[model samples]
Target: MLSSSGRGPSLVRSAILLAIAALVATFFTAPAAQAADGQISGLAGKCVDVAGASNANGTPVQLYDCNGSGAQRWSNPGDGTLRALGKCLDVSGNSTADGALVHLWDCTGAANQRWLVSGANDIVNPQANKCLDVQNRSSANGARLQIWTCTGQSNQKWNAPASGGGGNPQPGGFVVSEAQFNQMFPGRNSFYSYSGLTAALSAYPAFANTGSDTVKRQEAAAFLANVSHETGGLVHVVEQNTANYPHYCDTSQSYGCPAGQAAYYGRGPIQLSWNFNYKAAGDALGINLLNNPWLVQNDAAVAWKTGLWYWNTQNGPGTMTPHNAMVNQAGFGQTIRSINGSLECDGRNPAQVQSRINNYQRFTQILGTTPGGNLYC
Candidate 1:
């Protein structure tokens, strides 16, 4: 377990690798679903095609609807090779560069077509050491499919059937299809670290969904990262008090408040504070917030749930335009600014804020893109 403050560039890389390893282990721990019936849930409506058009080596393959045709009927072949329509799904010529095109070719026992199936949403190709990437790493539909280096991006994840199909059921019991799962959980790893962050999305219905919305996994992970960085991983604390409480502090009336009226604000996960937020969490969880504002820190699950409530309520990173914010750091520096400006009612040090901005910029650079823009706190 690495602390956020201690996570330098090298540590971040290690964390990413550790996350990948955890996902791989989880994938193997789950049993493979029966594909003998050819009844795949997610791929039923998607297209498939033969690689390379030649059914030979180095030919480009395309995706087309399944018509019981040999070209569309694929087999895992239990040898890391996908055999379908007498061809294999491959990375064109085994190239590992970014933006590499995927093609169909004859199966020669190469590693490109050999995939490790996790749930319905994630797949692993060992040869190129990457996952099948969705263009632009977006969650929108109709995005093109390609291969890219795996950095646990949401676009590369695919979900397979749970071993015994006994996990919690999503909104619908229908299991997410492999292709659809990949769309939701696209990347090399599927698990995210849960520590001090108030919003741990690991338990979100969106990430656990076995159907359509499961592709929002990356969004969930991003939310967790944003909140973790914002709140000092449960270290920083806030103060809580109700306006109606007897002897409450009011500058116009009294300078000294009653002992019971002033209480420590809830800490950790969602930073639960104010009567409104407590009430919201209470309503959502069917608890009485007025009686127990401390539930946030005392209950881990409740804390995380409150955090998700904020994330969902706010449009998240998508709320504002990237250009207006500059560098599009989203929840990172912007959140700190918000806290300091509104809550602290104190000016934040420009140097400290800029340092955080630099950290976020470096993070995005490692992932290979300039994130949209910064959310100016």
Candidate 2:
């Protein structure tokens, strides 16, 4: 999965790459054949499409049997992002690694989202310093795209959209799309859903939907990155280590751990745990979570709302809410402090702190915002 991104390997690789002749023998499958406007015909003469023609962000940009549908109609807009159906063709996770998936996502001006037309129309992601490659050189329909070491092979060649002009700005209202959510947490439990998250947004209108457009996008990325780290990309629906489950109960609270000593174990995007946390969050959201902490695990809306509750209100170990930390330009580091500063910040746990930072940077790139400074707590 190593990339040719660095200067040394890139220079050498470039000098060695030779453009191979285009495919022939099968007229219908030859990408060299004339392509109609607004379509990027490639290997097998298949048009690059948003898988299932879905406008959902993070949809795969794949070589499918060309049918001239709207999914195949692309616009270069000259912005470096290849857009179709209102989303950019992006390298998954903003990844530069070889074999990294190329998918449709919110059009962020991030390095990985930009593409360059190389010799013979090879679309390249300068961030990865690799060519857009059809995985395995298969000419079959539904073949996916990837970033690979540029070999100048036909698989790396694309009848890409013309690079120039401006495409539509990302659709407003919500920064993170359902497909982008899936991309961020490909293995996330089904318990967390985009609809569930959006459903909970009205609960905290200013959390991600506030300020300037950049601020809005940045805040959304910051919140998701923090939660992604806390939940391991939403893969864990609840605390994994059962040994620590019972420790979340605090009998000292007046509520007395109504769901049981272990029922309050970590759950939801931010690992909302503890009897007190459940009780407080429930009261704030007007739901009875103390007796049914499991609702955070069983109901998607409840699960996401709990995470939003913490992000919008609870400061935990720090002085400000995670929401305030982001919108106030206090830097992503502050959110870390607010969430788990006692355990993970200020070199208390460098690796874990870094995991949160890495997610922040990657997600900000995906959301089309810069990760402002003071990333370390």
Candidate 3:
């Protein structure tokens, strides 16, 4: 090599070639995939918005209805920071609490600025083991942003725009974040032990991919609204009445109650009761629920699936599935009619239907969709 570093023509040429190779390597080995610029939807169907559309450091990050404005746009540059308005989402003074404010600061690659965008739709700050939450789960405009324990509330659900965000006008996939479910039913942990609820719903393509974006949200909201009423916000995994525990069994059925006469009591999200319902739900879910009614209470995915099955299928006392009732514009009333119309519809019990209607209305508002007319059966 003509004495390494001595200024020979061959040595100079080789050095230039090595430098070019290094440059080429650097060019080819680019950073990780860049997160697409879009809005991140959080509590109350609001987007993680930039206050006043300001790009300056220390700008407040709050929840606002997604309006496609540049202020609401965000990016994850594969560098552990969620960037918006060219600023990193930073935790104020690196605090970890139920209400530590989140704001924009210059990108510093700090641990407090890093986040783990989980499959459950939670923007978790691993440094604190907390989530990016809309303070107090408020749905109103100008709600403050904070870092709180990952409670799986709707306020902590950060749906990226590309995934059919929580409030964007564009069509998005149907997804129920654990956080949203937690917000709707704060008492779930006491009864439900199942995890991966979002993943469970994702397995059923029809659940999230149904109808347009509005319809999808309506469907999900309606389902959850009715379910909230059915299970008291999923606080009760099974019916509470001990007397009715044995009443669900129908001894006349061909298969009978394999899970015992008392085993077929109300269980799962929709309170799937009776021997026939257990058998049918079991057949649909590929599990022997007729012989194992306890599965619904013991398995979270099975429990939610049972509820969804009933929502998508059985009309109960109504004329169509609850899913069809919402998508076909039959209104929320039809869903009540489909579920328990015999008891609650046709002026039999206005209060019950009204309760369901109230839930639907409130849930729809939270989801940012209008609950259509005929809210009563």
Q: Judged by lDDT, which candidate is best?
A: 2
Candidate 1 structure lDDT: 0.39
Higher-TM-score candidate of 2 and 3 = 2
Model 1, 1-377: lDDT tens per residue? 11121211111100111111011101111224443333222332343445333566655544344355555455554444555556766777666455667767766665455554443344555343345666675443334456654434455554332333322222322132344333422331222223322133322222222112322232333343344344543334332323323322222323222223433244444454434445444554455654576666565655665665444332222222111112122444344332232221134355545544554444344333443443345
> Mind giving the per-residue lDDT tens digits that candidate 2 earns over 1-377?
00011110111010111111111110001123336777888787888888988989878888888888989988777555677888888888867666899888887777677765543455666444456889999888888889875545688777755434543222334778787778878888777888888877644434564445676678788888877886778788777777767777768877698778878777778677667777777776668899998898888878887777666655666666666677667788887876677666777888978998999888888877798887888
192-250, model 3: which lDDT tens digit per residue? 54363554552233443334567667777788888777777667777777776766666
Which residue runs does candidate 2 get wrong by more than 4 Å?
Answer: 1-172
Best by TM-score: 2
Error of 2 at 17 (Å): 60
Q: Pull out the clashing pairs in model 2.
A: 77-164, 77-165, 78-164
Evaluate residue 140 in candidate 1 and report its C-alpha lDDT on the 0 to 100 scale.
Answer: 38
lDDT of 3 at 78: 57
Better of 2 and 3 by lDDT: 2
- The local lDDT score (0 to 100) that residue 90 gets in candidate 2 is 81
Kindly provide the TM-score of model 3 when superposed on the true structure, using C-alpha atoms: 0.53
